[model samples]
Target: MSIRKNVLFACLTIIGLLPLSFANAAPDDVFIFSGTRLPTALSEVGSSVSTITAEQIKQKGYRTALDVVEEFAGVTVNQNGGFGGVGSVRIRGALSEQTLVLIDGVPVNDPSSPGGGFDFARIDTSNIAKIEVLKGNQSTLWGSDAIGGVVSITTKIATSPKAIKAYVEAGSFSTYKGGSEISLSNDLGSFRGAFSGMTTNGISKAESGDGNAERDGFDSKTFSGNGLIYLPASAKITAAILYNDSMLEYDGWGAQTGVSDADVTSETEELSGHITLSLPLFKGRLENTFLTGYSETERNYFTSGSKTYDYFGDRLLFRYQGTLNANETNRIAFGAEHEKTTSGRDENSIDSLFILYEIKPMKNATISAAVRVDDHSVFGSETTSRFSAVYRPHNDWKIHGSWAEGFKAPTIFQLSYYFPYSSKVSGNQDLNPETSKSFDVGVERAFLKSRGIIGVTYFRQNTKNQIDYIDGWYENVNKVKSKGIEVAGEYRLSDALGFEVDYSYIDAKKGDGNRQLSVPKNSGSARLIFAPSKVLSAAITMRHNGLEKNTYGNVKSWNRLDINGSYKLSSKLELYGTIENIFDEEYQQVYGYGTPGTSANVGLRLSM
Candidate 1:
C-alpha cells in the first residue's frame, strides 16, 4: 500500500479507540471559515487563541488598543502613563519585544524604537473589525517576531453601498475623542476611509497636590484609509494606509539623579498593499498573494536628540487546498519575504523563505510540518523547523501537541544606540539573533448543549544566546527557561446571560540564576454579560493580577472592575456608557506610575 493510504488507516484506527467524551454535537452554526483551520473550537482556543469580535469591542466600551490588551486573556499591559502611556504586551511570560503585532497582516514593530515594541497609544480600537490572538510560539506559520506569538487585527470590510458613521466621547482629565468613517461600494470595488482625532489636557500623576511633573502625558491623532478591488472571477486586490503624528511630555528617566523635563515629538507613516488570486490547479484550489509595504519613523527630542528610520519590504505567498480521498485532505503553503531597514547608523536587511504542509490522514486527525531558512545581513544563515499534530475522536474533543524552533533578529535600536550610565553599559553592533525551541500540549472540548467550552494547555520554552537590556546595556545571555499552564472557559447560561473565566500561571528564570523581572506570574479575568432585551445589553468584568517578585526585590499587584452598557434606539443609532475603576482603585502596572481612576465615558454611534 502507498504511504498516504497507510497513514490514513492508522489515523482512523487511533480515533476509533478514544473515549466517548470526544463525541459532541456541532455548533448551531459556524461563525468564520478560518476557525475550522484551528485545532480547537472557537471558544476552547483560549489556551492559545483570544478572539474579540467587533461587536464585543463596541459593547466593552474601550477606547485604545491598550485597553483591549489589558482585558485580553493571557495578556498583561504595563502602563507608563494614562491613556497615552507607553505600553508593552507579555504573553507566556515573555518580554515585550518577543511578541509580534500585525495590522491587516502587516508587521508594526518599530524599526527605530528603543525596544522594537509597537506603540499601543497610536492604535484606536474603534476601527477594528476583529482581533485574533495566537499565543505560544507560532514561528512555524509566521516569521521572526513569532517567538512569543502573533496578534492579527483585521479591519472592517465594506458591504453596504454608502454609509457614514461617527462617534464622540468625553471623560476625566479633559479627555475627548471624535471620529467619522465613510464607506462606498459599487460594481467595480469598495472603498473605506476614516479620520479620528483625540486630545487630553491630561491629569497630573502625583496625589495630594505633589504634582511637579507638567506635560508628562500623551496627545496624538491618526488617519487611515483602505480600498478593495474585485475582479469578475475570484480575485481581489486591497490597499491600506495609515499615519500617526503625536507629541509626548514625560518625566525624564532617573538616570541623572533628579527628575528632568523631557518633551518628545515624532511622526510615523505606514503603507501596505496586497493582491490575491485564486484558481483551480492540480485538481485543487490554489491561492497566490503578493504583498508590499513601507514604514517611516521620525523622532525629535528636546534634549538634542533626533533620529529618522525607514523600512521597505515585500512578500509572496502560494497556498493549495484539496481532498486526497474520501476521508483524507491536505493543504500546502510556501512563501518568501525580504525587508530592508535604513537609518543614519546602518543599513540592515533580511531575506527568508519557508514552506508548510498539513495533512489529515483520516477523519478528525491532522498532522503538520514546516521549515524555514533565513539569510540575515549580519548573522549569516540559519534554518528552523516544526512538527505538530491534532487528534479528534469526536466533534467536541481534540488533543493537540507541537514542537517548534524560532528566532528573533536584533532591531536597529538594539545595535547602535549608546547611552551614558554605568561604565559596563554597551551596545554590540555584531550581536546575533536570539534563538529558542518550544514544546506545547493541550486538550480542548466544547459542549454544544450548554453552549460551554473549556481548554487546558501547558507550554515550555528554552532559549540560548538570549538578548536582553539591563542598566543601559544590551547583552547576550545564555540558557533561559519558561514554563506555564493556562486554564480557560466560557458558558452561556441562557439566551440573555453568559459568563467567562480565564487564568494563567507561569514560572521563569534566567541562566544567570536570577528570576526574570517585572512579569506577573498569575493573572485572571471573570466576566458576566446580560442581554435583557433585543435592544439593550450590559456587562461587568473583574481583573486580578498576582504580585510578581523580581530578583531586585520588587513586587507589584493590581485588581480592578469595569461596567458597561448600551441601548439601541433604532436600526441606525445606539447609545453607550462605561464606568472604569468603579471603586477608584489606586494601582499601577509599572512602579511609580499611576493609572486613570473612576473615569466614565458616554457616546452615541450612528450607522448608515
Candidate 2:
C-alpha cells in the first residue's frame, strides 16, 4: 500500500481496538460571551448568529477557520483554486466589502484589497477559541463595512498556571503542518505564546482541460502573543499582537486569465496589535475600558522573480468604552472612537460617537436601542440607528427581531487608485457612502429534554447609493434589495448518534433590473456524527451550492461530501484523519478555476 494509505489504515486500526461507552450528556445552558465590546448570551442577540465553538472545531478535525464558517446558514464561499488561494465569502446576498471581520476586538480588513475584504483563506484555526458569526446589517456597534454582518474571532489565552501543547500533520500533495502553544497564568499575571506554519504543493489554478498541469502552491506562517497584568484595584492591563506572512501562486491578475504554467507570485504580510486598560468603579456596577490599536497590511507582486507591484495599507484606532448597570433590569453602554487610514498618497480619517441602552421590560423580554453619528473627512457626517427586542414566551421558545441602519464608506482603492494608475476605469473621488436599512425576525425552541434545537429566521434589507461599475466608470447608480430565509435544526438522537441540517433561500435584485452576480438563490448543508466508542468519533458532512451566474456565464449547482474522524489514544495524545471531497466532486465556485479533488490527511496532537 502507498505510504499515505498506510497512515490512514493505522489510525483506523487503533480506534477499532478501543472500548465503547454508552452514556451521553448535554449542557443545560450554552453561553456566548456578552457585553458591549465582548460577547453576550445567545438569547439576547436579535440578529442571526452562527457560532462554532472550539470543541466543535477539534471534534470535526477542521484545519482552517473558513472550514467551520462554511457550514453556517446564509453563508457561501467562493474560491479561485484550492487551499491558500484567494477565497471570498458572501453573507445574506451582501457584497464582499460589506462584511466586517474582527480578531479580538480589532479590525483586520485590508484597504489595499480590491474591495476591502479579508481573504478567509489566510486565517489559520490553530489557536482560535471560538468564531462568532453575526449575520444581518449590524452597524450600531461596529461602524462602517458592517452592512452585511460581523465575524468575530477570539483566540485562546492563558488560563491555566502553566501548560504546553503541540501538533504536526502531513498529507497528500507534499503538504506538511506544525504548531506549538504555551501558556502561564497566576494571581499576579498571565502570558500566552503560539506559533503555526503550513505549506503545500497545491493543485493548479486553471481547470483540468487545455493541457493545464502546472500546480499553484502556498506557504503561511503566523505568530501571536497575549499578556495580562493584574492591578492593585479591580482592574488589569491587557495587550496582544498577531502577525502573519503568506506566499502563494496564482495564474494572472488585472485583465487576463490565469496561465497553467507560471511563476507569478504574491507575498502578503499583516500585523495587528492592541493594548487596553480595564477598570471597575462604584463597586463593579460601572465598567470602563480604554483601548488603542494599530493594524497594517502589505503585499508585493512578482513576475519571474522580479517585483512588479507593491502596496501597503495602515489604520490606527482609539476608543473609550464604558458600560453602566443602572439596575438589575437596565444597562447602558457608550463609546467614542477615532480612526485614521492611509494608503499610498491618499489619507482619510473619521471620528464617531455611539450609545446603546438595554432594558428588560418583562422577566423574559429584553429590548435595546442604539444610535451612532460619524464625521468623516470626506463625507461630512451621517447618523445611524438600531432597535431590537427578544422575548421568551416560555422556557421552550425564544423570539427575536431587529431593525437596523448600516453604511459602507468608500475605500482608498475605490476612491483614489485611479489617480496613480489611470486606465479606462479610473477612480472617482466624488463617490458617496452606501447606506442600508434592514429588518429581521426569528424564533427558536429547544425540545426532547433540551437535547435538540430548531429555529427559523426571515430577513430583508434595502441599500441605496451603492457604488458599482456603470458604463466604465465608478458611480453610485445601483439600489439593491435583498431578502432571505434560514431554517436550521440540531438533534442529538441518542447517546451514540447526532445530526444537524441548515438551509437558506435568497432572492436578491438590483433596482436597475438584474440579479446579483454570483449570489446563489438556494443552498443547504447537513451533518451526521457517530460516537460508537468512548475513544473514537466520526462525522460526515454534505453541502449543496445552488446555481448562480458569474462573469463567464451561468454555472450549475454542485454537491460535496466530506468525512472526518478522531481517536484519543491517551490523556495527552490523540490521532485524527480527514477525507475532503469524498465523492471526488469536480466543480468550481468561480469561473476558470480548479477545485480540489479528493484528498486525505492524518495528524497527531499532544498536550501537557
Candidate 3:
C-alpha cells in the first residue's frame, strides 16, 4: 500500500474505534517541572509537552527509554541496528544534536562527539520514575543545545514506607533480562536503589545478505540510587547517582567490500551524579535551591580483540535558582548557571542567567514570558526569549500559543579537531552558533462528558547558521525551514477498554528547497488497551513510519505490531509477557542496518 493510503487507513481506523462514550478523564491537577523549571499544572502550561509515568512504562513492557519516547507525537528515533547500537532522536525535523537531554536535571550529552548528542541506547527503563518531553525551542529556560527541545528523565524515589520489587525475563536470541529495586522511608528521609542488567546474542549489524551471517552480541548493566533528607527550618537535601557499562559487537565497513560483516566491538562506561539543597524563607513565600552535578563517559573500540581507538568526555555544573510568590496572581523564577565541559585536552565553559515571569491576568487566562543570556568562552554571548499564553474559554475547551528563540554553540570536537594528513578536512575555529525561531498554536477539547480529550497543533520553525560538513570542512552554511501538524487523542470506550492515538505530518526543507534526509513526512502510532478484570490486562500497539530518503537510497515505509499482557497471580506476584514484530516483518531503519524479526519474552514480577 502507498504511504498516503496507510495514513488514511490508520486515521479512519482510530476514528471508527472511538465510541461516543469515553472512559476516565486525565487528572487536571497533574504537575510537570520541565515546562517552566517550576511545578506547574499541566492544564496551565502553554507548551507542547508529553509525559510518561512508571506505570505506563511497566504496562507497555518498554525495555528502554527510547522505546517509550518514540511513541510520542513530533518525535522520531533511528538506530543503526538493534540493542546497544548508536541511537539518535530528532524533534520536528531538528538535528539530533540540537535536542537537549537530562538525567536528574543534569546535562549528559557526550562532549567528545562531533555533535554532542545523547545516545538513547544507554538509558534503561528499569530505574526511571517519569519522563517529560517539551517540544520546540527551549533555550529561554535551558541554555544552548535546546534548539530542538528538552527531555528530562527522573529516577525512581521512595513512594512508601518500605517496598521491594524485582523482575526476570528470558527470550529469543539467547536474551536474558532482570532488575530489582528497594526503597525505604522514615520521618527524616527516604531512599531508593535499583540495579538492572541484560545480555543478548543479537543478529548481524550489516544487512543479512552477501555472506553476512555472523551473529553480533550485546551486554549491559546499570545501577542507580536516590536519597532525600529533611532538615531543620523548612530545609531539605537530595542526592542521586547512576552508573552504566556496556559492550557491543558490530560490523565494520571497507572500501573494497562496502559494509561487509567484520569482527569489531566497542565498550562504553558512564557515570553521573548530582546533589541539591533546598531552603524556604519568608514563611514559604520565597524558595531557593543550590545544585552541583558531574558526569563522565569513556568509550573504547576494538578490532580483532585489539584496542584501536578511545575517547573520554566529562562535564561539571553548578546552579542556583530562586522562586518568589509575588502575589496571589503572579510568580517569578530566576536562576544562574555555570557549566564546564572537557573533551580530552580541549575544554570550555559557559555562564548563563535566566528569568521567567507568569501572571494570571484573568480568571481564565495565563501569560508567561522568559529571557536568557549565555556567555560562551569561545563564541562570546547570545540571548534568547520566549512568550506563551493559555486561555480557557469554557470548562472543557482550551487554547494555547507560544513563540520562542533558541541557539546552539559549536562542540569542542567540532571547533578544535584537526586533520594533519588532509588540508581540506579540519574544524573551523571561527564558526558561529546556530540560531532558530519557532511558533506554535494548539487547541484542545474534552468530549463525552470529559471522559475523552483531543488536541491538534500547528508549528513552524526556521533555523540559520546551522553547522555542517561542507567541502570536507566544518562550516555554518546550512539553513533549514520546517513546518508540521500534530494530532493526539485519548478515549475510554468502556470500563474495560481504552484507546490512544497520535499522528505527525512534517515538511522540512533546506535552503535549496531539497527535502531533509532521513526524515519521514508521515508517522504515527495507535494502541488499544483492554482490562476486563482487576487481575488481568492486555494491550495491542501499532506503529507506522513513512518512506525516507538516505544518502544511498530511499528507505521503504513499514508497519509493526506489538502485544503485551499481564496477569496478577497474587497480591505481590505477577506474570507478564510481550511479543514484538508479530508479523515477522523484514525491515531496516537505516540503509544497511538489520532489524529484529519476530520475538517474544515472558517474565515474572514480585513486589512486597
Candidate 4:
C-alpha cells in the first residue's frame, strides 16, 4: 500500500475506536522537570513531552536509554550494527546533531564530534530513575543544540530509608549483563550508588549474509552515585557523578566494495558530575539554586592492533537560577549560565541569561512566555524566545499549544578542523549558525470514568542556514521543513489487561523538494500487557517502520515482535526472561549493517 493510504487507514482506525469504553488514566500528581526547568505537572506544560518512569523501565526491561525512547511517537533511531555500535536518534525529522542530550540537567554533547552530536551507544539504563523528552524548538531555555529537542535523563536517588537490589542475565550471542544498586537515607541526608556492566561477542558489523564471517565484540562498564545533604536554615546540597568505559569493534569501508569485515576497534571513556546548593527565603516564597558541572570524554581508535587517531572533549559549566512566587496566580523563573567547551587545544565559551513568566489568569488555564540571550566567544550573540499556553475546559479535557525559536552554533570541529591529507573535506570558518522556528498544538481527552486517555498533536518546523558537507567543505547552504502528526492512546480493558499504541506520520523535505534521508514517513507500535495477579506479568509488543531512504538505496519496510514476562518467586526475589525478534526477522536499520536475530535472555532479580 502507498504511504498516504496507510496513514489514512491508521487515522480511520483511531477514529473508529473513539466510542469504545476504556480506562488507564495517568496519575494527576506526576511531575516532570524538562518541560519548564521546574517541577511542572504533565498537564500544565504546552510543549510535546513524553516521559518514562522507573516502574515502566523495569516492567519493559529496557537495557539502554535508546531502547526506551524508540517506542514513542515522532522519534526514530538508527544503529550502524549490532550491540555497542554507533547509534543516533532523530525527532520530527531533525538531524541527530540538532538534538540536545542531558544527564541530570547537564549537557553532554561531544564537542570534538564533527557536528557536536551525542552518541547513544554506551548509555546504559542501570541507574536511571526517569527520562523526559521535550520535543520542538527548546533553545530558549537550553541554549545551543536544542534545535531539534531536548532529552533529559535523571539518575536514581534514595527514596527509601534503606534498600538493596541486584540482577544478572545471560543471553544469545555470548552476551552477559549484571548490575547492583544500594541506597541509604536518614533525616540528615541520603545517598545512592550503582554499578553495571555488559559484554558480548556480537554479530558481524558488516552484513553476515553477504559472506562476512568474522564476529565483532563489545564490552562496557558504568558507575553512578548521587548524594543529598540537608543543611540548616532551609538550605541543602546535592551532588551526582557518572562514569562509563567501553570498547567496540566495527567494520571499515572497502576501497572498491561496500562494508567489509576488518579489525578496527575503538575505546571510549567518559566522566560527568555536578554539584548544587539550594536556598529558600521569604517563608519559602522565593527559591534559588547554584550549580557547577563538568564533563570529559576521551576516544581512541585503532586498526590492525595499532593506534591511529584520538580525540578529547571537555566542558565546564556554572549556573544560578532563582524562582519567585509573587502570588497564587503569578510566578517567575530567571537564570544565568556560563559554559566553556574545549576540543583538543581550542576552547570557546558562552554566557547566557534567560527568564520565564507564567500566569494563571483563570481557574483552569496557564500561560507562559520566555526569552533568552546568549553571547558566544567566537560567533557574537543570539536571542531566542518561546510562548505557550494550556487550558482545561472540563475535568477530562485539555488543550495545549506552543511556539518556539531555536539556534545552534557551529561545532568546534566544524569551524576549525582541517586535515592536510584529505582534499575532499574540510571545515569552513565562515559558516553561520542554523536557526529554526517551530510550533505544535495538541488536544487530549479522558473517557470511560477517566480510565483511558487519547491525544493527537500536529507539529511543524522550518530551519534555515543548515550546515552540511557540500562540494569540499562544510557550508550553510541548505534549508529544511518538517511537519508531522502524532497519535497516542492508552486503554485498560479490565483489571488484568491493558493496551497502548502510538503512531506518527512525518513529511520532511529539503530546499530542493527532496525527501530527507534516513527518516521513515510512517512508524508505529502497539503493546498488550497482561497481569492476572500481582506476582505474574507479561507483555507482547509489535513495532513497524515504513520505507526509508539511505545513501545506498531505499530500505524496505519491516516489522518486529518481542515478548517478555516476569514471575515473582518470593517477596524478595523475581525471575524474568525475554525473547526479541521472535521470528528472526532479517532487516537492517542502516544499509549494510547487521541486526540481531531471535535473541533470548533470562535473569534473576533480588531486592532487600
Candidate with maximal lDDT = 4
**Could you give candidate 2's per-residue lDDT for residues 104-135 as a string of tens digits?**
77788887875688888878888788898878
Which prediction has more favorable TM-score, 1 or 3? 3
lDDT of 2: 0.81
Clashes of 2: 4
List all candidate RMSDs to the true structure. 10.6, 8.7, 10.0, 10.4
Ranking by lDDT: 4, 3, 2, 1
After TM-score superposition, the amount by which residue 152's alpha carbon in candidate 4 deviates from its true location, in angstroms, is 0.5
Consecutive 10-residue window with the lowest summed lDDT within model 3: 19-28
Provide the lowest-lDDT 10-residue window in model 4. 19-28
TM-score of 3: 0.93
Clashes found in each candidate (C-alpha, N, C closer than 3 A) = 0, 4, 1, 4
Report the error of model 2 at residue 65, Å.
Answer: 1.8
TM-score per prediction, in order, is 0.85, 0.92, 0.93, 0.94
Clashes of 1: 0
Q: TM-score for model 2?
A: 0.92
lDDT of candidate 1 over 1-608, digit per residue (tens): 13223333432333233222212222214243222223234432222567787888877766777777766656767766565666778777777778877776667676667556666766788678778777766665666777777777776655466778998877767777888988766555666678887778664432212344554555677766666555555565555655577766555454322233344433344333233333434443555555654445555554334543333222222222222222237666677778666554566777878777777677677777778887878877878888777887777887887788878888776787666675854466766788888888888888976499887888898877778876677877887888988888989999899998888887877897776766778888898999989899998989888787543334467789999999999998888888988998877566555567788888888887
- In model 4, which regions exceed 4 Å deviation? 1-32, 255-258, 420-426
